[model samples]
Target: MMPSDAPPPLPEDLFAAARQARTNAYAPYSRFKVGAAVRTADGRLFAGANMENAAYPQGQCAEANALGAMVSAVGGQRIIEVAVVGGREDDPQDLCTPCGGCRQRLREFGTETLLIHICGPDGRRHTTTLGVLLPLSFGPDNLDIV
Candidate 1:
């Protein structure tokens, strides 16, 4: 058993998945590759790599791709946690975090307390909750739904 005050150990599988996914990223413009993985409440894991487009604004984020995979596999499932890794293709040791849009995208399927594990080439470097990244945010619960 682990102590209540102690932080949970890093999910090694998620880190490996995310790191592997980063190699598949299509980044012709910025040369910045990113990978992201998400674990659903049901324990399902999904990973994805960033894909850049000719038009800068049209690029797809790694987190969005991972979420899409989860939604396709199991619709409407809640995301319990996420891991994101990113860095320049040449040097993948720098730390990275989800963008504002990606954060909102994650919010669609996760709660404010959802944990996001930030990682670098070494491994999981930091951990933070969605609420900390996006404070006082609105979500599906904020509006009417069938």
Candidate 2:
């Protein structure tokens, strides 16, 4: 999670970054290109795209890849704002929200107020907070510390 529970407003370019990353998705099997971008507590932005593998579950979601990029950049910065863009290459769908597993993954580094922006390839978008999306959920604090 972030060093502080309360985070500031989102950056202006987060969605652009996510959409740009979406162009680089590696989804040969599903053709569903998804991209994710997260802003760290310090204001640095990182982006990642979905990658599919022949081994099915071995693939990684764009959210996971974005989180990995955040960690790789400076090691687990709290994700203050998140933007996700996804749609089939041939057709731009209406919804592109994170999957169930990816939602939990986002919880690993986000607090209740973390803002999530869901976007369609057609440029339509929706905004919601993590608290609203994953209410009454489990997280790191649920685990007993040593």
Candidate 3:
């Protein structure tokens, strides 16, 4: 068991899980595998890999998958941080950030201050916030729903 006051897992630790998740990606079309991990406020981590489909746009991104797992296991939990890792073995420009749609999807669960890390499978890392990734974005509050 971890101490209550123990520091949350480091970015690299989350990236490592994302890297492992990437191996399970089902990307036969684009061949671009992506993995994502989400850390909840309580330090719980959930990881997911991209699943592609032959039918266009009938696939789920790694970020969405991770968020789905997080919410399914812990309803009403807010995501505090997110780390995404992806790329191809042949042309490795990993440091994969959430796509536009994924960013919006994440906004549904994470606050504007949520930390986001884009990382390569080899451990390259970059950090930013959801607000930075999607500035002045429309969200639940925009509709007076939050």
Candidate 4:
């Protein structure tokens, strides 16, 4: 069980996870590094970072990589919370939010999941929901085939 006062994985912790993922990233082009951390419903944490390619379209988003890691690690479990960050250095000073495709992916797995975006040295955080991230989102509910 997660500790009651687990402090929601401090900004530094999140940054560490992101940075770790960043290190494993296979970015051969577009040095725009991104990272993601996902918390499983059972409280397991998984992290992933952006992997760019010379082909551009072949690149993978940080969120997608994180989701893949989470799925592979936890089997089938809902994601509770997710944090995404990016920077040239592993500093928690420069971060950004997930892109549109990432948001949609989040909504598909957990529509109500908490998405946190942190930036700056002070670890200023912006909290939002997948619903807000993907307004009028498409999901399993939207697809019907008989």
**What RMSD does each model have against the real structure?**
3.4, 5.2, 5.8, 5.5
How well does each candidate superpose onto the true structure, as a TM-score? Answer: 0.88, 0.84, 0.84, 0.74
RMSD of 1: 3.4
| Model 4 ranges off by over 4 Å | 1-12, 87-95, 120-122, 141-146
**Which runs in model 1 stand beyond 4 Å of their true positions?**
1-6, 88-93, 144-146
Model 4, 23-129: lDDT tens digits are: 67676677676777877767777898788877889889988999998788767567767777665345554547678888877866675445455433244345566
lDDT of all predictions: 0.84, 0.82, 0.81, 0.67
- Which of the two candidates, 1 or 2, achieves a greater TM-score against the reference? 1
Candidate 2 global lDDT = 0.82
RMSD of 2: 5.2
**In model 3, how large is the Cα lDDT of residue 131?**
88
Candidate 4: residue 33 Cα off by (Å): 1.0
lDDT by residue (88-146, candidate 1, tens digit) is 43444555889999999998888888988888867766678888888888888888551
TM-score of 3: 0.84
State the displacement of the C-alpha of residue 124, model 1, in Å, after optimal TM-score superposition.
1.4
Query: Across residues 82-106, which tens digit of lDDT does each residue of candidate 3 receive?
Result: 8888754444554577999999988
The alpha-carbon deviation from the true structure for residue 16 of candidate 2, after best TM-score superposition, in angstroms, is 1.3
